[model samples]
Target: MISKIELLNEIGIALSAEKNSQKVLELILDGAKKLTNADGGSLYTLNDKDELVFEIVSTDSLDIHMGGTTGQSIDFPPLPLHIEGHDNLSMVVTSAVLNDNTINIHDAYHADGFDFSGTRKFDENTGYRTKSLLTIPMKNHKADIIGVLQLINSTSIDTGVVVDFSSEDQKLAESLASQAAVALTNKKLIDEQKALFEAFIKLIATAIDEKSPYTGGHCKRLPELTMMIADACDKDDAGALKDFKMTEKDRYELMIAGWLHDCGKVTTPEYVIDKSTKLETIYDRINTVNARFEVLKRDAKISMLEKQMTARETADEQAFKDAERDYEALIEKLNDDKEFISVANVGGEYMAEDKQERVREIAKYKIDDCEEERCNFFNEDEIQNLTIAKGTLTNEERQVINNHIVVTIKMLDQLPFPKHLENVPEYAGGHHERMDGKGYPKGLTRDQMSWPARMMGIADIFEALTARDRPYKDGKKLSVCLDILGKMRLDNHIDPEIFDVFVREKVYMEYASEFLTPDQIDEVDHSKIPGFSGD
Candidate 1:
């Protein structure tokens, strides 16, 4: 006679070992197989509707991954062998549902007119010896039947062949199920934690976008671009990145990096952040330039009348004619100037040195017969000393623009980032820095930069180079942007290795495909990504 002690010990062993569900299930099946000495066993876990979810095999795939369904979920409900006429497994399940304690039914397989819906699984696939079987409901302390545990080929341990279902084995089967209930509960908790973390990260990204009206699309676009680059790089090899298989850790890092890359912008002042033009504050220098052009026109008219008098080409003829034409032409060129042109240009946002000097020559010189200095020009020294090239502004206005990096760094420094995310503040702040130590907020150099910092640098340049929202500058075409970035790399303004990876992987194509606006997307020339095997 088997004692309750042995059954209690088996349940204790099953519950004590801590592991994931798959490993725990294997242990359960192993104990079942050993107690019954069956050829092998399968553990059937049910869904909420009592339907089979997974039929976990005790053996490995190498040990005959049966085709006709030895180790798969069944199409029909498997019938228990213990009761005839009524479905035996259904009766056993009903007992658990109602908390009934109906005991052992002998000669279950030999019951009259019995048919096995699971027979095809056994008789067709394995064809191993099978006869008597034992099954019992697996339940938790709450009396919920988590699943059913079964032992096949049950026999009198004293005898060599299969025999009737014994009372001792019945008690043991129920014990293992209780252990499985705990494992199920643990898995559910882990899934909930993972989902909560993902939602939290998305919330942070949304908060960053809310800071500035212009940046409402920034958080969304950056990740799209970052992932595109990763995808392009992924296509280069066998769906891996630099000898790594794009694991969960790598994906998590990229996602966090993309989201927090601009967290430093939180410190950036609102006015400077939205400073639409070079001469954005303290003065609308366009007004001042227009006023200067009027003075030039008035002086030109005087010069023309004087010329006419000197030539006896008579003042009466020249009086009504417009000598303001030459002055108008100069004003038009100053108001609508483009970048990277002659230093002899002026107006719009900034005044060139030569342009400032010429304006000074015209206005600053006393006519040798003036009343007061109503039209003095900005001297070259005063023009060179200010951040605003054309407009006059207080020191505070310029400081606000430079303080954006300071804001970004301060906000991120407060967050509790994982150790791997330690570089986020520095990486983000370094975007505005230049190669020649001319960049702001602690101008880091090539040697001081990390891969993440470099990634941020590239992403910043890429976005600004292609952005269509700047009031002072027109967006560049993709081809032009790429050429500019290539030159920046050549000029030591950007990291060479990163640029090499970008060109080799054709990274911009992936970014452009996703982040670029519809009009921009259509116009871009995308290079083919070489190794896009996302297996």
Candidate 2:
């Protein structure tokens, strides 16, 4: 048998080690009951309303268990610490809290200077005797009363008869109550700090999203998709992912990483992010190019009319006819070139080599500028934007966009995260990296990165491919997005094991159903998806 001193030490350690609030309360009540050999006990916490709320109640003789981990509510009304601006000293538990002292009653039925009517009523209804009571005020290190611990019916060890709680029992209970109060207070403080930290993180994400309408929900969606794939990998018990698992702490850390993956984008220019066309800056420059085309057509028509007048004055019918034909042909060719430039300005997945050459050819067509000086139809900046091989961003602008990941890494590295979340910088910063060592910011290979970082890579791609709110293009259908994701997998851009789990578990469909529009949700043929065998 464990000695009383040994038991007390063990209970104190257990109270300090417990993380769950309910379990801590349960431990405190159980430890007090064991120390006194009491038949029943209850724990009360002081709420913000100045009321003592019942946290746990246990009676061994009646087989009664309520509150705490038992999932049964106490159902009793809270006892107010004050009534009509005065301390309610009538109740024994409240009196212990009000006086900041322990009260030991030899027998409740004959107790003095305190009300025991409730105890008498309870005994009458249950056909049990009301006997000895010991109530102690629970105080923290600050010497402030936080709660009350009440023990009932301390029975003798040999005779099993009710006895008063001895002086030794009171001392032991007070020491245990002190430990419990500190442990509870520390846990509450830690929880509040964590909540505040997460709220601030989410606030940053929301601010980044609000910076651009094109990326209105990217920050929110990426975390959800990342978690979905992570959950799939966690549950997978086959092949490369069978060993993968996450505790609640690990899950929370990953969630923070997901929210912060694109934190660097806050530094990126909004014009580059929201560029809707190849010729876009503050506004589309194609409109300026179109105006120049109009000027060229007017010049050609004026020259043709002058030639016609000269031919008529010289009586040369052939010259006049030639001028008319030339004017008609020039107008048609100008319209064709203007239409072609409009299409090129819109941009697409691939701009053919022939069409790129046509832009250069059109740039050679000269016109008088606003200064009345002769210059090429298209300026150097305009030509650079118009002839982009793919997407709206020029190489320089693309680099500007990619620099956000570097900034994100730097920002997260400066923070002094705790041990559990120490990997957040790695996870958030590595999302843009590749398995083949071809990714930017840091060309880390698959072996150099964690599974969570690789999972984030897939989520980032999938969300970008399927997001409907982007200014550049409409959201791709489910099959199309999966097809692109499959190609990326084949190229070693993402983790093959995570991708396998993602497809096998149907995480894409699950996400699509929740976030994708009806038109974006199309039939997906699993066998046709690239880089995946129908296993």
Best by lDDT: 2
lDDT of 2 at 105: 90
Residue 381, model 1, lDDT: 37
Can you tell me which runs of candidate 1 are displaced by over 4 Å? 1-180, 210-213, 224-247, 266-272, 275-453, 463-475, 517-535
Mind giving the per-residue lDDT tens digits that candidate 1 earns over 164-222?
A: 55665665565555666556556556658757866776677687667656566676666
Scored by Cα lDDT, where does model 2 land?
Answer: 0.92
Candidates' lDDT values, in order? 0.55, 0.92
Estimated TM-score for each candidate:
0.57, 0.90
Model 2 Cα lDDT, one tens digit per residue, 185-280 = 898888899889999999989989998898999999999999999998999999988999999888999999999999998899999988989999
TM-score of 1: 0.57
Candidate 2: deviation at residue 462, Å?
1.0
Best by TM-score: 2
Clashes of each: 7, 0
What's the distance in Å from true for residue 427, model 1?
A: 6.4
